[model samples]
Target: MLLAILLPFLSFMIRGKIITGIICLILQFTLIGWLPAAIWAALSLQNARAEKRNEKLIRAIKENSK
Candidate 1:
């Protein structure tokens, strides 16, 4: 996520979110948008992590119940 802090737009690209990345690129160009871009990228990363953990938890529960 260090990269995301440095280049917020790239975070979306790495995640295959081309359109959102493009939007971030535009926002990044506006100097004032820098902070918000970083915040958005960081939040997105956290959300992705949460989703992965939830999926793993569900899988584990299913296996245990079987």
Candidate 2:
């Protein structure tokens, strides 16, 4: 079971293919259980929100500079 989940990630790591790696990771998490998926989803959402806030701050700084 661990091998099954690790295979895709290992392949992706070898190939350095990020999209497939992420897809495989999500699939593995889903197949194993929902907790990891939920935690990662929450973290992803938080990071997205942080990025948006950073973008807003950057825009404000640019506007003030102008």
Best by lDDT: 1
Q: What are the per-residue Cα lDDT tens digits for candidate 2 across 2-56?
A: 3223354444544455775577566666666444544444454466569999999
| Per-residue accuracy of model 1 over 1-66 as CA lDDT, tens digit each | 997889999999999999999999899999899999999998999999999999999999999999
TM-score attained by model 2 = 0.53
Error of 2 at 56 (Å): 0.3
lDDT of 2: 0.57
lDDT for 35 in candidate 2 is 44
Model 2 off-target regions past 4 Å?
A: 1-31
Worst 10 residues of 2 by lDDT: 1-10
- Screening candidate 1 with a backbone cut-off below 3 angstroms (N, C-alpha, C), the clashing residue pairs are none
What is each predicted model's overall lDDT from 0 to 1? 0.93, 0.57
**Superposing every Cα of model 1 onto the true structure, what RMSD results?**
0.7
